[model samples]
Target chain A: MDTPIRVHGLTKVYGGGFRAVDALDLNVPRRSFMGFLGPNGAGKTTTIKIVTNMLSATSGRAYINGVSVMEDPKTALADVGAVVETPEFYPYLTPMETLHYLGELRGLSSCETTNRGRDLLDLVKLTDWREKRVGKFSKGMKQRLAIAQALLSQPSVIILDEPTSGLDPRGMVEVRDILKQLHKLDVTVLMSSHLLNEVQEICTDVSLINRGRLLRSGSVADLLDEVKARKIDVRTLRPLTPDMFDRLRAVPGVKGFAVTGDLSFSLDFEGEEDAQARLLIELQNLGLMVVSFKESGLALESLYMSLIMESR
Target chain B: MMEAASVVNNRERLPSDLQQMVTVAKYDVLKHLRSKRLLGLVILEALLLGLTFALPLLLGVDPTDDPAGYMSAFVSWVEILVIIGATMFAGDAIVSEFQSRTGYLLFPNPVKRSTIFVGKYLSTLGIIVLMLVVYYGVAAALVFAMTGGGTLLSLYSMLLACAYGAAAAALGFLISSVFKGSTGSLVLTFFTLFMILPMIAQLLPAGSIKPWFVLTFCGHVISYIMISPYPTDLVDSISLGNGEFMEYWTYYPDIGGSLAVMGGYVLICLALGMYLFRRKEMVS
Candidate 1:
């Protein structure tokens, strides 16, 4: 029940009066995986920046573990570690040396620093390249090193701004596993990504914002149930007549239906299991060649599109 | 209860913030040492000393013929070489970090910006001083072996050279922090040091602005040791007088005044650079 981070009515305006984020509020519980999902230019990154105290919030408040980022950033940031965009490091330095420098900044004892550095390098699967200069690292290698460094202080809340944007498929899998592993350690993770599937596969909760406004925020299950109450897709062997389609649409609890494809029809209802039995009976009575029917999980792409479309 | 107690004990060992800043500083100094840039600069000082002796021999200039005039010209050439090397080194120190995007990782830590600034600055100055010591050794050996006209005045002049070298390095650090790119910072530093500042000094009425050239401060400080009429026949081969002031200010030389001016210029510029860097948003 403890809130690790809270952003209240946050808004940001750029020069010449362009609003990037407006009237946004978010609450991330401690030790939860919170995904921030939106289309490009939807204020997802802006929100992360404001919460991390990188970009100034025009009118709002942000607190990290009850410490206001505005009132005391030095103390507030003490528990927060962030990797904004491409993580930069001294090219001439090896990954181990880079960690040693950052460890010092995080107050690690020399012995503890070396031990932690080696452990993290091994965790990121970079122990083999520990002494190699970072300049020679590929983009994926550099990103993995960045993640290890972010975890160096054992921060309570870790924020990653599109941490896996440009990675290859293998790299994305590596990053996803890394995030999942961190989640096991009781660390609160706030990640922003335009990749919907990445968010869908990993996040326990999500907050969607668009056009400088908060569209929706909740656990993936809650948001899915709220927006997808009556949507069901049924596949049949042949196209149905208009009268048969109308009858199905006029069912007591059915909200809507659409022939989305040649053999598949989308059925939307007013409530969960509202008329699910009645729906099956009607299709059976009509002697319709029903082949297969399925309910979609809370896929972020659908939720994201619905949220953005409703806002417009 | 035992598990809970162990967990509580684990949290107590976390490092405090000041300890972290020192660690970051130590890492930066170590990286510089490994790269051997400091050693290379010190070797430059040795090379300058060698040039002083070798050039005279190569051109066949008799040391006994006008020893004072030959010594003055040699001092100026060495001064120019020292200034060039120190400026280039200082200018690249901080700006290179920005260029490489390394500041993004370091600045976001729990440490204060001033800690990073002072740590890097002092480490760089240490390297310059190392070079100065080497230069001094070579200069002393050359003075005794080649001229046999060695005096304590020559030794003191070398120390003054080191002081001026430190000043130049500090000034370059300030400029490096202001400019964005390494190449741009270097070009601007050299231009300001050589072309612009002296030109401005020339534009002012002769005595009204000589102290403005940091090189002028060096010229004055060096002239005091080499030009002052001290009896060289003394057993200790040491004497002190107010001759550097005369060479620098000519008619209106003030040694304390020159030191104060140079000190003021260095302090103000460094303060301004730090303020600018602290507020700057690193886009890279």
Candidate 2:
């Protein structure tokens, strides 16, 4: 199969004896939207940097278009576009100048650069402010411009590191929509983000990492299946008293329970959906409370915590 | 995911490489040409030249009495222009990229770093040279109209002086590439070309240095016309009051020496500048 990106024995060490990334192996198929999920300080940025040819790898190889990043970085990165970490742009130039400049650098003809630059500006919804100097742009505006610049080459693969780290709700939704549109164009996207909900929303596949090591990598559905099924959060109007909480845990199908806060307690169910029904009845019969009951599918926050805690 | 089999099956090699390099160079030249600071510096030099040569002849000095004497005054005017203009022009040719944070935008392109160094440096030099030529033409016309003696010879001397100015500008450009800040480079260029070189000539024993040192080094190269009026007795004297400065001093450039000095300064400084530029991590 034609993989857009493949990593083998990838590792990185910083100056002060810190092994920022251990020997890690990864594969990303072409045209797939893959979420690179990792907590803070988990080497996500380092891996993206190495893959994009920004940082040299200590002892590994990342390949793009079958070209080795280590052996021939220029060609290996020829078809890859990336915005690793906070995007930086020349503040004095307008978006059009910045995009056209990059387009020319990538060998686009003047006509082609102008045409493509126009289209990319429209795509990022910055066509109106194309002439405004980037220095005066808001953070969201800059991020949009960065995305425009990244897509100017129409590369097969695009990597973004926490591309939505500091955006308002509207900005986040806008960026998410842009990612979806890019996916529809068949660009293989490898995005690193700590926001689990954002990842779960857009990624078809995911690779979870923590503490500089890979915890799991697979299709999101398959990886979620591998995670130990956990408690279901039932938010209700009244709190379940300490005694009622214990009795709910004693329900035959229920294995254990943990109260997240005052109104909700996560009750672990061992069996199938029928067991979930049984717990609901027992709680109703006890006249405790039942505002709402639903299965919270593998809350990545808890999953991340459990994985790290269990490994330690 | 696109089938890996299909990707491997459809891989094709394209036959366009030279086009890429030309595209990069074209855009870089365009961007360099649009720099207002560079253009502004060039215009400013042109105005100063007009004020120094045309205004003085029109308002104050007499060139008709002694055609060569007026040419001598023109030599001093050109010297100040060369010193000030070269210092300003060359000092920011490289440092401004860093200050503007546009260094990353230019350096990481498909073009080789050396292409950028030569392309931008040469273009700036060309602009500076054009300014000098314009001033030279205007001054020669004014001198011809007034004194009308040996006009061709006077113009020949002016061209020689401009050549020396080009060398000074090149040397100053090299210093700009070496230093991080434009102001520091400007001050350094002035000190090296104006104060330091002349100071050394005065401090060194007579005849200990070569004739080139006494005849054509530092500002003396451009100001040699003003010194030609000096008789032999005042040739060795330090004062310009009694000295009859020649419009042209016939000391051929120690080509090897000139190359050695300029090449050492240019290549070494440019190498370090490229190294620093390449090593920059390009943080915004």
Candidate 3:
């Protein structure tokens, strides 16, 4: 039995001929952290909603843990935990109470729910706000609580739709830390996000989708290897003037460049190590003292955009 | 570590349908209470009780005499309480899940949609019942204290009130299932119960047709049951020019018939409401 999250010819044509998800077939292997990556309106959320059984497909099928969602959602989703589209709570329930409510629905006893709730809350770092009403908490706090609830049932498969979306930088880090902890567990995670860096930090594999269709999918390393292009960040001791920007863009092997800070700019280059070394010498010839030069680590971002353009 | 394994094992086991309903009901009760909708209705009930006892004193009318008539005055107020309860608790039972996106949190669970509908319906009905019981309990005690006469008829009225509440709340749930926003559901449910149905009942009885199909029409049984001999329909006619007559009519609902009408609403409206709730998607 293939217990991975699988969607075959899954299509969702909303009212008025809007195809939110069009025959999107994806597979997240067992115990693999697969990033369902795409731009906004790329059918990522629509596919996730279908997989979670929150919305019916126009046609085709979705399965979670080897059970067909459209046929028997209750059983297909029994071992699945999903947070879809910026989930909101009852607002009146406290974090602890929310966990208990969800835990009981999953068939845990009072003692077990309590213990699991406490452990989950502690894991999400929401213990201090355990008794606080969710309505009074900020969006970040609610997002963190969402993580706690998703993991409360100890589900074998966890689905998160933009878990770090709409959070401040600090909140994103907090949620990322929790996600990192999940990566250590024996659970399968199928998280959807528009940002490549967000999933690249933790996901084992990624699927690039666009306009309701899957464009490409593979291991994180394989996808990165497919596109050797990178955006390198270079910080200088002295700020470059307007003319200096023109000269910097003209450097050999430097395909493009943008001003990042007063003393720094990012160079979009595609080349081997010899061309990259020549780039440093070119910058030195311009009388600029290089403070730092390194890759920003968003290789798949370039590939994602190029595929979206080609798919169109 | 051993305890952790046991906990994990416990979670893997799915609960029975009945257990899921109970769990959903339990949490729904907490939602209503924590939202203060239940408490607000109770406070309003207390105020109504206060007004019921106070209005008579201020008007210098003694409830001690004709205790049956005095207690019967509560019938109209109880009807209003039931409407308010239905509007507040049941009006948003299903719509809020979609409008607020809380469905994202709930719909993914292993529980069935029918189970969620019944559980929420029970919780809403339970609150209305509690409100009715408190109102009737006080009225009954006052009537018992004022006279040693039997308050048997008031019990019937209270039972009818609960039935009416159930029907009205089911109607509210139906409206909630149909509408997409809280305000729209609340306004439609309140007006449908408080004004629209009663007006229809009034107009229909003029044509010698009982609006027995209307739940609010049957709700009048709460007060009419208090009147002895069970009042029947009344008619008054005014002679126009040339001996033409214009007839005006007043209708009283029958206990058995009206109870059946309300029961039909409880079944049909809930069936329809559950159907819509199950079919509703969490899009947008």
Candidate 4:
């Protein structure tokens, strides 16, 4: 409750028994960039919608800066800026005019809103199109504009759902760059994304969920440590037969194995570099010519997959 | 060029409910101004006013000998203006927010849903008021240019027309809140107010039973107020040549009773519409 954002026992069962979020509890620490990672139906967007007070939960409470979102949403969301999904603005309005309307609703003065809105436009790289109608904008452009609006109030907490989902590679980098600035500003950021590497790069903490249930929540460093037990892919100069599969499985600290290619296979190993070195020696002792041996994917991605699989 | 820290210390108080409502309505009004529907209303008004002027000049049918009669000719289309204005402004007010997915940006704000609804309602009524004032202003000027004296009954008729427009807009908002698509809501609102209710009003004519409670029936006061004492029900028997007779009658609404009926529709529809809007969730 004392955190910048806290969701406790939140359950949202939509009409027709679709349980979008179930007893989902989460806390975003102050000044921490939290990555809310989940699969397609993992209730990430639902939780964001509830915390932003866009959708009502079936039961339980979500608080912003200790203010209850349900009991007093206006106060709870005063310092919270969010983009829950692919948000669309009025096509008739230019960026500046749209900002005026929203800024007025948020009790910002005209001069202040204009000045801040210009800054946000520049931050999102949209200052050139401030006077143009939003109707002509592409999806990526709108996504950037959405980010700008979320930061217009200089909110203490920022929630973004797939902020870079529709962007080109350059646009994605630009948005990520803006996000990096938020880290320096010390804004509590809760961004939901399927891009694990991006989360690994920008987030300090993460809470992964699956099927409306929390799988794991901790700092990115701790999660990486949990996944130091990595999946190492090994390649050979010759094809492996059944007897070789048996000998490969017999190695110490190798928990799982899958044949990725005719001459290559992946092993789920359980140790640091020292254990990896011993496994390489054991594989070479099996009398196969080793070609390549390396970690397969990112540490957070491995942790995300293992936790999500375990939850299922 | 923009300083986040400079504004961080300048975060003022959140807006009051009234201020929020005004903010919402202000943009909604801007939307109306920018839309093609307002242009459509303007065209409708110009056509109606042009007919009023050209008919009097071309056909030499100047009823300006009597001020009420001349003004009645101009005010005859008042019902259509109100109905069209309601259809244009209020018909899609609530549904467009949902259908077009604008609710995503608008609904999650710190502003309450009730405030948004009231703001939109005021915006609709505001347009209706402006339409009535302009249409009547043109009509009053034309009537004055023709007739030497002013028409007092036209003023009462305009007042009734404004009330009737408000009730119509309220009903339109109710339909908008209940429907999913803008086209269906707009069509249904215009059809229900202009076609269905008036057709039903025909069945319960003045002689036997009065549909005094019907919103469209009450809307008759906007025009019928010009008729002194509001002419009583006329039941006439038509003679078929072979001694077969058919009965037909005309219906007119009383001024006071019709105003009361219009007021009732406004209160009921406004309450019900606002309640539904507040309870609605932004599903998309």
Candidate 5:
């Protein structure tokens, strides 16, 4: 199957010799919600900008489907919906007007534009404020309206840059819920974000990057399983001593441990679940008051941190 | 609920470039209509019309005696008003797309940059034309009411005024394409058209260089065409006490010459502006 987005050796250098994106390569498969994970100033936005033809690539090339973005953007971008950075619309225009304008530009008939625009406005939950000027809207409202605009064309692939950034808790959840709905609908989504938990929840596949370079790209399940590590938290009824720490370290599967408190500590165990059970038994065998013991699920946060640290 | 799968599956035929251009122009016109600037320009036009009628009445000059002279007088103010409309509508059209980050929403659409530029230019010109129609319509009605008839010179003057407005709008778009900020482009457009070019025309010795090279020189034809026996390139001389004569030449751009200069400006500036706009990256 043809990739919805493909980049090879894509490099973008801003003025004053700053390489924002350096020889980056990426591929987003069709019908996959790929999380583009990166930190601040990690060239995620730059790469999206180039793909949208908002910025010219200094070297190399990017393509949407089979068309080159730089050489032929009009045709290449015809089937693409994008929200770069934050959402900004013409202040004087209402959400309805904004969507109609964009929809007509994308070649929908007036009737179709109206019907689809109404549907999109309702989908984004902006139907109540459809006629109100966008200037009075809060940032989250604008972001939601931006998503509505992006989906106006019914694009095959959607590229969003930090869709949930700068939102309040409720706003974040609202936007995440919309994204979840999009995922269930099987829309090909490539969203860039630094929120590890958000990606872990919404994305099926992820590409982790730092300093404008790709670190890892695969299914989330495979990546978490490949790390072969688990964080096991244990709590004791009473304060432990140095002797107990030595005895805990002597467990066969305990690769590392940190004493979070006098009566509590967490262990990094690299083993199967049966071995983990054995380690739990051994902890009790060491004559410690092991009040509670549980193994934390593998987290994308640790994998992201480890990969970023390794790359640096 | 709208089916996301159905919408994604049903793809309509994309409109041609010309159709898209018209769509863009229509929406841009809607933007202007909703903006206070259009209302402001209309109010300014009404004020100019008030002056046009009140000035002649205050001076106790019967326009019926010489309708062409009245038109010539009115054309001067009309030119100024048209130029103002041009600058306001076109001066920041392109630059604002970048400065305000509206391009982030706009540039990703399926339209070409050239299409966007042309659409904006046409819309700005449309507003200017609309303004001129009102201004000239008032002028024509006033002349016909006072004199019992209208002169063909008014028609020629209106045509010249429109040509001048289009040229000025083209110049504004060129400035907009060069500057990254709307305020700078707008200020510079007004300064170049009103102050700089007029200053050059005033400082240069007439007959030395044609002054025809300046946009303001072509602008004179809008009023000059209204003159009954249109002025020629005759230099006026006044006698000084010391027996030396100070020469004053009123440079008149004949109809053909004025058309050529305005046409040159419209063609060159629009071509250059579109080229620059096409090449410009939305860095902001």
Candidate 6:
């Protein structure tokens, strides 16, 4: 199958000798939600800009479904919908007007544009504010409108850069839910973001990039399985004394332990799941009244941090 | 995934380049219509037209006899309205796309940069023409009302005013493409066209070749078309105490010459502006 997005030796050097993107190579398979994980100033936005024809790559090339974006942008971008950096619209226009304009530009008929525009607006939850002028919209509303705009053409591939960047918690969840629906609808999504937890939740495949270079790329399951140790959180009915802490650290598979709260702490267990169970049993046998013992949510976070440190 | 595949296969046909250009132009016209800038220009034009009629009455100069002369004088002031309107519409049409990050949404589409540029230029031209129609429509009615006759020279002056407005818009687009900020482009276009060019035309030796090259020189045809027995090369002369005579040459550009200059500006500036816009990267 042809890859939805392919980049080879893509380098973008700005003025004053700043290499924002340096000889980067990446590929996103069809029908996959690929998380483009990176840090600030990591050239994620730059790479997206080049792919969407907003910026030109200094050397090498990028292609959408095997069409060279640099040589023929119109053809390359025909089936691609993108929301790069931030969402901005003509302040005078409403969401419906903006979508209709874009729909026409994308070659949809008037009836189809209206139908699809209304449907997309409903999907983004902007139906009530359809005719309201966008200039008065808050940033979160604009971002949602931008998402609706990106989906107007029913594009095969949707590329979003930090789609949930500036949203409040509820807004973030709302946008994430929309993206989840798109994922289910089989859109090939390549979303670049620094929010690792969001990526871990929404993405099936992952590519980690830093300083304009790709460090790792694989399935999230495979990456998670590669983690050598698991950090398991343990809660006790009462605050543990120093003697109890020493006794807890003496477990056979426990590599280290840190008290995170008065009655809770975490343990680094360098062992398999069965061994972890055995350790948990051992802790319970100590008669310390262990309330709960479960693995923490630091698996992906640790993997990302270690990879970013290794790349640096 | 199958649903998405089917949807992609069943997608509507895309537009051709010409269709896309027209779409962009139409939406841009809508944007201008919904904006206060167009209303502001209309109000300004009305005020200027009011001044044109009232100034003569206030000065006790009766133009009740020579309607052509009154029309010519009235249009001369209205020509400033055309300049202001063109500058406001076209001055930031291209630059604001970059400065305000509107290009983030616009440039990613299937349309070409040249199409966007041409679409914006055509929309700006249309608005300017609309403004001119209103201004001249009022002037023609007043002339007919006052003298019971309106000369063809008014029509001829209207054409020249349009050419001058097109040139000014072209110049504005050129300045807009060069600058990254809308305010800077707007201010510079106004100052260069209204203040600097006219000042240069005034400061240059009356008969120098430099004045002919300036856009404001071509703008004179709007007012010069009103003069009867149309003024010759040198309209007046003045003598200094040192026995040196300073001749003030009438920098009247004939119809063909004026069209050439204005058309040249339109073609060259538009081509250059489009080229720059196409090559410009959306780094911001």
Instruction: For candidate 3, write residues B143-207 as lDDT tens digits.
Output: 66666564778888899999999999999999999998999999999999999998888788668
Which tens-of-lDDT digit does each residue in A1-312 have in candidate 3? 344698899889998999988888898888789999988889988888888878888999998777899988888888877888779888888898888888888887789778878888887788898998888888888888888888877777889999999999999999998888876677889999987888889899999898899899888989888887789998999877877777877877788888888899898898888989999888878887988888888887888889989999
Q: Give TM-score values for chain A, per-prediction.
A: 0.80, 0.88, 0.90, 0.83, 0.88, 0.95
Going through the candidates in order, the fraction of native interface contacts each one reproduces equals 0.30, 0.10, 0.64, 0.52, 0.57, 0.68
Q: How much lDDT does candidate 6 score?
A: 0.86
Predicted candidate 2 versus true structure: per-residue lDDT over B99-162, tens digit per residue = 5555534433334444555555555556556666766676666666776753444565566555
lDDT, residue B258, candidate 5: 79
| TM-score, model 1 to reference | 0.80
Winner on lDDT between 1 and 4 is 4
Pick by TM-score: 3 or 4, better one: 3
Q: Name the regions of candidate 3 deviating beyond 4 angstroms.
A: A1-3, A238-289, B1-12, B234-237, B246-249
Q: Which 10 consecutive positions of candidate 3 chain A have the poorest summed lDDT?
A: A1-10
A-chain TM-score in candidate 4?
0.83
Regions more than 4 Å wrong, model 5? A231-252, A257-267, A273-298, B1-4, B7-12, B55-64, B238-248
Docking class of 2: incorrect
What's the residue-level lDDT of A44 in candidate 3?
A: 88
lDDT of each: 0.70, 0.66, 0.85, 0.86, 0.85, 0.86
TM-score ranking, best first:
6, 3, 5, 4, 1, 2
List iRMS for all predictions.
5.1, 6.0, 3.2, 2.3, 2.2, 2.8
What does the i-RMS of model 1 come to?
Answer: 5.1
Candidate 6 has which clashing residue pairs, if any? none
Candidate 5 lDDT over A241-281, as tens digits, reads 78777787788888889888988888998898789889978
- True lDDT of residue A6, candidate 1: 90
Q: Name the lDDT value of residue A140 in candidate 5.
A: 95
True lDDT of residue B128, candidate 5: 91
Steric clashes per prediction: 3, 15, 0, 0, 0, 0
Clashing pairs in 3: none
